[model samples]
Target chain A: MRPVVPYVTAALLFGLGVYGVLRRRNAVLVLMAVELMLNAVNLILVTADTTARAVLPHSGQVFALFVIVLAAAEIGVGLAIVLQLYRLRSTVAVDDVALTEPPVSAQPVGRDVEAGR
Target chain B: MTGADLLLLALGAVAVGAGVLVVSTKHLVRAGLYLVVCLGALAGDYLVLGAELVAWVQVLIYVGAVVVLLLFAVMLTRAPIGASDDLDRPGWPAALIGGGAGLGLSVLLVDAYRWSTVTMPGAGTAERLGEQIFRSWVLPFEVLSVLLLSALVGAVVLSRPDIGQPAPQRGDTAGDTSTPQTVGADGVRR
Candidate 1:
């Protein structure tokens, strides 16, 4: 098999991931884009395993496995964070999620942070 | 081109196409579904490249766990189910950057390979991969396990907001909060 096919594929995938990450507003969608980039990297590593000479056998695949593990952990924790964000802020848009605390007047809904206290 | 090359090319096309749909589609759930298609096609590419174990692992972890987790987050966030126009920022910038990156990399890779054929490697059977992992890669493997443990604990802690915060206002299945103007804001509006 010509190795360039997979290499170019990985490249385009990574590019798409970059677009998704930058374009998507939702945090979950951003995470999905991040997954795309990770997958593209994994594809490159696995392709390199077959094409490039390496000292350790299956090293590319091993790194791919590690990448997979990392991705799994990432998604789990990422979802937790997203869900939590939804809980507190009631939205998951990357832009809408302000880094600094909003003024008390800007609180969207009547949460009554003081309710029942 | 051999059958394997053709298969790889076809699967690559599927992956790239679905990836486009994943980022472009307006339907919130459909994007997740498109991701499944894209990832599955990549798995096929892996099989064609002789990484048998990696292919299956891709299917198992990426297709199974990660996509599921994404869908759950989508639903949990109450993301708009059908099409909403404003899921993305202005298209030109993303398109320009993504296109530049993809085309440049493609040009470089194509130039490097330049129609050179490669001998396919031995199939990465589970047994051989396991041996390599346990023998030479044992330390990283153990460390990865620790990372996974910490991630799990951290996810649990992060999800359960009551852990650190002084007041526990609501549960994980967040409801009762009327989320106004959440559509253009780009997420769920409860």
Candidate 2:
């Protein structure tokens, strides 16, 4: 197969992933998008590895393997965080989890004073 | 086109189509299933490219372990299984960005390579992959193991925050006056 075919596929997959990551409000879907992007990269790597008839032909496959392992590790940690977030907030919507301080009007004066301390 | 080329094209189409479905599906569980299809098709692509070991690994790791873990999390978190109104935002910006990126990258790649073909070396066997993993990529392999270990620990810690915290004191009963335990939503004392 020509190399461009896989390259084009990877590019489209990556773009879809990027769109999902940006547009999805659910945290798990965002994580899924990230996985799609990683898979695209893996496809590209394997395709390039297959095409590159060099001294170390297996290098690209090895790299893809590593990416797989890393992806596993990443999803593990990411889902754990998501679970914890759900526990804390009772919801998995990313927009609701405001890491920054609440607006001044929304803050309780006593808690705000304690936080200042 | 040869059989391999045709198979690659078909699998690529499946993979890309499934990938799009994965991101666009409103049902969370359906999206996970679509991800399985996409990853499985990618494995088939790898097989067509002569990376046999990687293909199976993709099946074993991604389709087997990762998607299952995602589903477990979804079930555990009680994520909405059906369509969710808040699951997505306005589509235009994302579609614009994603489509533009894909088109631009495709144009660049086609311009760069101009349909040139490269000869594949040989089928990558498990034996050679093992040698390369142990002999040349030993450090990274070991490091990945370490990473997995750390991720396991982190996941455990994050999921169960009470693990390292001090246990309830001997006098801290539900009725104890000093502890001031509150009833949770499920009517459990906390």
Candidate 3:
């Protein structure tokens, strides 16, 4: 098979992912874009496993699996952060996730929303 | 063209088309669903390339778990089910950069390996891949396990707001365990 098809596909996928990340304001959407980029890289790795002659066979596939694992972990933590952001700020827009101090009106809430127990 | 070439081309088109929709769709839930389609089509591409293990892993992890988590997050954040005009920013710069990077990479790769046929490797089943991972790539695998563990801990901590907060004011939550009066209040809260 001609490998260029998958290669170009991966490139365009990564590019689309980049556009999503840059243009989207929703944090979840940005993470989804990042997933697109990661999947593109995984495609490249698996395709390279078929095309290249490495010292260790199937290394590309192995690495692709590892990348999948890494991405799972990333999504888990990323959504957690987004949830916490929503709890504090009431919005999941990426524009408002500043590292500065909390807003003035946010100081008086007494309850921990998640620590219900 | 060979059957494999045609299959790759077809699956690649599906994957990219779905990917565009994933990022560009107006409906938030539809974007997540479109991500499922895009990733599943990429899994198909992997199958066409003979990477069976990677394809299944992609389906299980990316399509199954990650998309579900994203949808849950969307709902949790109370994002509108219909459409939100504020989801996107100005796009021309993003388009310029994304298109430039993609085109540059595609041109480089195509020029490097234009019409050359790919030499198919050995069948990358779970058995052979496991051996390669355990025998040669053991250290990285172990480190990845540790990383997963840390991510678990970090996510738990980040999700809970009461984990390590100092008592800024005694009146903030008089429901301290030391006081029995607020016990009824805390009980009512729970």
Candidate 4:
């Protein structure tokens, strides 16, 4: 009964995090929201493992530790890329990035060369 | 309602509300702050579940490390601190529809699983968890360490300044790529 308390709370937290990740536009904030979601899942896993007899495998906590490490590494790489994007372009808006190079028409430089001649 | 139920409800409300605010707020920094509140409530929930080790890890990893990285990234990227003019997208209608469907599914799942009750074996402690981690999950744990190593290397590579570009002369320009480049109309090297 007491364990159910955490499970319900964790579920609600996970729901909210899902909403955030889906709704937010900022990439960094999206990552933060993702972290919240992962944390919520970790809470549920820990609670479930602790409360259940057969499911009470210690792997849940170990898996959670792995999640934390992975999250840290992800943030590091993600932020670096975002910073790079910000440097290359003036903004970090997801829509602003061009996955492929924008096509450009070659402008005639003959007139300027002729004038120089 | 029982004491446990009431407590859970209160904590759940706080966690949910804060989590919503983390996404809803336009200010990126403020959103990170709201995330902290949400995570802190989650740690509290972990405590209520009798998972002291997990609760501390929640505080250490999510509250401490992850959120700090988020704040640093926001600052480093120089994302606008004030409210963004562009908040919601035109696709919000589709998002609402999808969200509603997912919510309905989750509700159905919860109702279906309501009959299952969890029972603990003996007392679950950190020592027991450690024994299992080292004994059974040792291979996966080592693999995770390898993954971390790769990530560390990847981060260093990604953060490295572009090697193709010539280093900026000290008198003419700042050497750091973090600074914005100002191009002259004549296009002479800065």
Task: Output the number of the TM-score-best candidate.
Answer: 3
- What lDDT tens digits, residue by residue, belong to model 1 across residues B1-190? 9999899999999999999998888898999999999999999998888888999999999999899889988887877777987788877898899889888999999999999988877889999899999999999999999999999999998765334533333331134355433322422322
Q: Using alpha carbons, what is the TM-score of model 1? A: 0.87
What TM-score number comes out for model 4?
0.77
Candidate 3 C-alpha lDDT tens digits along A1-117: 899999999999999999999989999999999999999999999989888999999999999999999999999999998998788878999888777876554444425442344
TM-score of chain B of 3: 0.90
True lDDT of residue B60, candidate 1? 94
- Which should have the higher DockQ, number 1 or number 3? 3
TM-score of chain B of each: 0.85, 0.83, 0.90, 0.76
Scored against the true structure, residue B81 in model 3 reaches a CA lDDT of 84
Clashing pairs in 4: none
* All models, RMSD in angstroms: 8.0, 6.0, 3.0, 8.2
**For residues B1-190, what per-residue lDDT tens digits would candidate 4 score against the true structure?**
5565576668777887887788678788898899889888877766665566767877888788888988988898776778886754454753575356446545654665563545544434678767878888889888888888888888776655432233343333343344344333113542
| Tens-digit lDDT track of model 2 for B25-128 | 88999999999999999999999888999999999999999999888877887977678777898899999998888888888878877777777777889998
Sorted on TM-score, best first, the list reads 3, 1, 2, 4
Candidate achieving the largest lDDT = 3
Candidate 4, chain B, TM-score (2 decimals): 0.76
What shift in Å separates residue B133 of candidate 4 from its native position after superposition? Answer: 0.9
Model 3, B1-190: lDDT tens digits are 7999999999999989998998898899999999999999999999888888888988888888999999999999998989879999899999999888888889999998898997687778889999999999999999999999999999998886655554543344564656555555644754
Rank the candidate models, highest lDDT first. Answer: 3, 1, 2, 4
Model 4 lDDT tens row, A10-115: 6655665666666665678768767777777787666656654554366566666667777777887888787766755657666667788644411122222212
**lDDT, each prediction:** 0.85, 0.83, 0.87, 0.66
Every candidate's DockQ is 0.65, 0.49, 0.80, 0.32
iRMS (Å) per candidate:
1.8, 3.3, 1.2, 5.2
